[model samples]
Target: MTASNHPIVGILLLAAGKGTRFTAAGGEGNKLLALYPNSNGDQVPLLAFSLSQAVASGLPVRLVTRPDEMEIIAMAEQFGAAVTLVASSGSGETIAAGVCDSANWAGWLIAPADMGWLRSDDYVQVAAALSSDEAQARMMFDDMPGHPVGFGKGYGAALSQLTGDHGARQLLDDTKLVKLAGHSGVVKDADLPAQ
Candidate 1:
């Protein structure tokens, strides 16, 4: 795709975090590497599923991962994403690195790496909202703002200011946010494995 199509919104898929919870649950290594059973009853790599969605989205995608995560970086590259290796800093730093040059796009879509179950078209819908007049937008599932949050170019400074676990949430205050209704995948995130 040309820059024109992706000029509206770029996808920032954060994957640098060490999945401590997953490791604690008797699952070794990164939770992203843990095999999860899919709908078809076939085990799939969590990161791979997530990476494939970002690739199928057709948006200009950047995968932010730790320098040690060579496997994840390689997989991300295979899916046609610009992979960026960070210092394994906090979530905020990972995001900042992913959107280092925000001026090229109208907005940035913050998609967490663990949210792989979201449908491909969901990415397209969220992106469409960014190109509109909305300065900031997010998926609304069950009456709450959820993941895959899209922030317009006007919030570039705030985005850049992110440093810890904080993300675009701080900027939502006192601002009109466009909420697009989405399914469960919009809010679903892999925190701890199921009991």
Candidate 2:
């Protein structure tokens, strides 16, 4: 059976937090709105790049964003993604909203908005890891933990309780993680402009 036959593993995109660092670093409004080149050389919004990758991975997606982010929310909905407007700008709050919206999914793949370089293959691999007997899967590159972390059903309550800048750190640390090692792109976050 293919992945479509299995229970859906949600890809929750965290887009609510204000990108203070990114904004201070010269990025316009939401860091997500900035245009960046994609693997195909197309200039797309930063969040669009990541959302496109998640959509290509063949997984369900839920987006947690601020109420003011109508543009981003509209774009994500265009891809058939569920949108949850969050009141707080904290990473944890954003995640919990996404998680609650995706409560029906078999597992959860938590990804941030700024890590736009990740591709469909990365999302696919992480989903595969969470589909198995393992309770959780954390995407790792060069031995460093990164986004798109997968959480098994056991993490629902704890994940729902998350509410600060710390998204899923505590929940992930408490679970037995099946590290999905991959190319360095797994860790390529758009935190700073490429030189």
Candidate 3:
């Protein structure tokens, strides 16, 4: 969708986590940089997979990562996403920074950087929910809630106020939560180097 048609909704790609588990699982490489062969037989970085999905959704994208991750920034930029550097201490800080940067957006579709399997249509569904009046917050999941939750402009203030390790969980509890059909990729994360 074009910005003019859905001026309120924006895509926020959260990639600032330290990936401690991944480092432990492997040696020193950032899990996002880990290469995996796709069905096409071409090796692709884990982060690029997620980014490709985001771009396919056709939403304006903003990538959030730590200042030191120039590689991540370059990769995201190559995929045509605007990049923002934020502290990687926790999800709360990274999300808050993303929200602060997207303050002018009417709503946001937040996606975790590691969720490589999230389909483009999944994002489309969440964005569609945000376009509706009843969806204050939309979560994508099957058996349970998962990543890439959508938040309307109404919660921008609360999202911006987030601190510490807290995320949008608190806001979801306070607003009208809409649960969409689950996508298996939503639960997939590069928790380990081998994963």
Best by lDDT: 3
lDDT by residue for model 1 over 101-173, one digit each (tens)?
5557778888889887776677778777775534677787999667788877877766776888776667774
CA lDDT, every prediction?
A: 0.78, 0.80, 0.81
Name the lDDT of candidate 2: 0.80
Which has the better lDDT: candidate 2, or candidate 3? 3
Clash pairs, candidate 1, are: none
Least well predicted 10-residue stretch by lDDT in candidate 2:
186-195
Better of 1 and 2 by TM-score: 2
Q: Which stretches of model 2 miss by more than 4 angstroms?
A: 1-6, 131-134, 193-195
Backbone collision tally, model 2: 0
Mark the 10 consecutive residues where model 1 has the least summed lDDT. 167-176
Q: Which segments of candidate 1 are over 4 A away from where they belong?
A: 1-6, 101-103, 132-134
- Model 3: lDDT of residue 75: 98
